[model samples]
Target: GYRTLRENDTGLNGALEIPAMRRLLPDLRGKAVLDLGCGFGDFARYARAQGAEQVIALDVSANMIDAARALTDDPAITYRHASIEDCTTAPAAFDLTVSSLALHYIADYPAVVQRVFDSLKPGGTFVFSVEHPVQTAHPVGWVRDADGNRLHWPLDHYQQQGARSTSWFVDGMIKYHRTMETYVNTLLDRGFQLRHLAEPCPPAEVLQARPDLEDTVRRPPMLILVATKPAKRK
Candidate 1:
């Protein structure tokens, strides 16, 4: 729904989403997992294939929920139409929570982060990815040199006259970006331990095949964040 499954329903986006989840959560077997922004439930399907005991895919789009229900008959998989900020109806129900290529669209990201923290069982894990702030720092349109060589842009290239303006190409969709520090701080405040934070650097083979956007690809286009809910101690 609001997760932009339509904008990124292509094979390439699918290719990117699957591997990213595998990297973030290495051992998901027999775990109760929640897939937020579960566009078409692709990642949920992948988690089941990886041997997750149960998986619930939630999105804000009803069309996506209905379409996902029709696509597969796997009894262990369930799909729901709900926003991340409203996902705490059952607190601490999941052992793992994941949202891929999502969260950037949320204007109130701290609330979303808090909901995710509240949804996980103690000792549970949470992993998610979103467009890197660096991507936002770069200008929307890059310039090419006469020799067709691209010049590297400045760190604040996208900042115009000390005011940052957001650009949306399709139908004025909303996007909210937080700095790296802001992201980390939110997790800490929610009692989540930051375990791993990375920008996916696809395998060299994938890059070699598509060299058109080498410059942009070299930098972090998407940032992966991993955190955990601590186990209860008596």
Candidate 2:
């Protein structure tokens, strides 16, 4: 049902995330790619179209893998049903590793980042997006007037980090919360060289399509990053 459930992302992902990724991603021609937490293989298919020779699309959900496999007939793509935590790949096996909007759901991001670092070839690229720390900093929601007009958003206990349960397409979904420092520092600690960081904004065309999303300017909903695995030293 992710295919049907994703319509709401017209502005957030379609406008912001996708554009940011296209700008950040290095050329993928003939690259061996790993897509961690690949939901329905949309991105994997895109990687193939971008000229990647092989792509492994891994996800924790069996249903999601099934959906991806059904849609992907390309011999270049392989769908694996596995959790990011348990999934394993040989060292220097891939030229690129990418994940989108999936890191927030992972509790042990540090370990997973290390895993990705190990999975990539030296000098390989890693790009991913997660819910912005500002958005994950608290459970607070928009405070609206009696007329249901927006008053203001509230923030509290931002320094506290842990699991947050909120309803979305599914009820009682759990997402992990971490500060931006934790995200950036852990990648550096694990030996990645940071390349780019982005708090993406919807393009004018996106804003024109959905004027209500003007509120995204007040707060960013996502954070995107690009990093590189260091090559072996002489």
Candidate 3:
């Protein structure tokens, strides 16, 4: 079963993530797009509205796919039930592939990145967001004082990367933890040209909207990666 966690939140995903991605994203006019881990197809709908020629949105959960399909009525957008690890596409089929906060859940990142690289056209772009290494470096919370006052976040086992369990909308959610080097070098090794990276802090407007989120500015929760596939040689 899938749960909708962030849709109700107005702080990070709505303000920081979407705005950061839009800043780096090239024009979407008349392009074939792929939305990996397309939960409820929000980005897919946005791409279609932005004039994408076609959009293929895929998710590992059937409930998510069903929700996306029911909410989306456009002929240009197709939602499929598939995992990022197992999903395949025609070579050089997409002009852009965008994912939002989903990669950390996948354990086989290298293989999946290779798949994404293979699925894109020459010079195509892949923009994605994931949990930041600092946040994922350890699953433990901040060490507070005797009064339970705030304290600093802890970093442990950073060099050791593997499964990290946490409770979100549901209990016992599992996600993979990889170092920043692993993330960047893996893409480079797979032939992706890293263009931009972001560890976004909530902006002033977002802070004003939700003052409690001020700490998110100091502690970056998410990381954004923008990479491109090189054009074929002549």
Candidate 4:
């Protein structure tokens, strides 16, 4: 379902999230990469194209792994069917670790951040995106006027953080909600130096092509962040 949406290249992920992620990502040349919640292996392929020496792509869904495997031909990119919660990595294994729009689905955000920190080599980078807190704070959809025009986004329960269920391609999909403070502070607590933070809006070209995305400018749907492990002091 995500593959279909992404391949169509018409959704927010393609038009907004992916572009923001690419902008925040560092150079991949000859680096070892780890892609958490790799989905259909899109980032794995992109990393290889950017000259990453190797990529370990992991997804919780076997179907996603199979689809990715079928689409991928690069021997350097390995696909594993494993949940981010359950998967284990050798310490300091990757030069770059990335997760795209998947961390919100995980309940233990702090644990994941800690794991990512431990899995990175000293000075390694971590870049990831998640559903913005505004959207996740209350996934009650939008407020509409009498003519069914979107009036504005409704935000409530921001201070309360925990599980929230909302529909996507399917109904009752669960996602954990965390405040912006929690997200940034978690990385800081885990010894990551914050590099950049972005709540990206669709670019001009994207808005010109998809006028429906005008609401995104008012309230961004995705949050992209970059943090790096501190290099050991000599």
TM-scores for the candidates:
0.84, 0.95, 0.93, 0.96
lDDT of 4 by residue, 1-234 (tens): 666766775568788888889988889999999999998898999999999999999999899999999999999999999999988999999999999989999999999998999999999999999999999999998899999989899999999999997777755558999999999999999999999999999878878988988989989898988999999999
Per-residue error for 206 in candidate 2, Å, reads: 2.8
Per-residue CA lDDT of model 2 for 119-207, tens digit only, reads: 99999999999999888877566778999976866676678888987766665567888998999999999999999999988778878
Off by over 4 Å in 2: none
The prediction achieving the highest lDDT against the true structure is 4
Poorly placed runs, candidate 3 (over 4 Å): 1-4, 146-148, 169-172
lDDT to native, each model: 0.76, 0.88, 0.88, 0.92
Off by over 4 Å in 4: none
Q: Using TM-score as the measure, which candidate wins? A: 4
Please give, for residues 1-234, the per-residue lDDT of candidate 1 as tens digits.
444745564333544545765777958789899998897787898889889999999988788888788887899998989887676558989999998877877777888878887888999998998877776554364556889666654455432212235565546555665678777888998899999987766567876875643553656667889999999997
The C-alpha RMSD in Å for every predicted model, in order, reads 3.5, 1.5, 1.8, 1.3
Colliding pairs, model 3: none
Sort the predicted structures by TM-score, highest score first. Answer: 4, 2, 3, 1
Per-residue lDDT of 1-234 in model 3, one digit per residue for the tens? 344346656457887788888887879999999999998898999998889999999998888899888898899998989989889899999999999989999989999899999999999999999989988989677678999855777888899899987865556558899999999999999999999999988768768878777767767888999999998899
Which regions of candidate 1 deviate over 4 angstroms?
A: 1-17, 146-149, 157-170
Query: Where is model 1 poorest over a 10-residue stretch in terms of lDDT?
Result: 157-166
Residue 24 C-alpha lDDT in model 3: 79
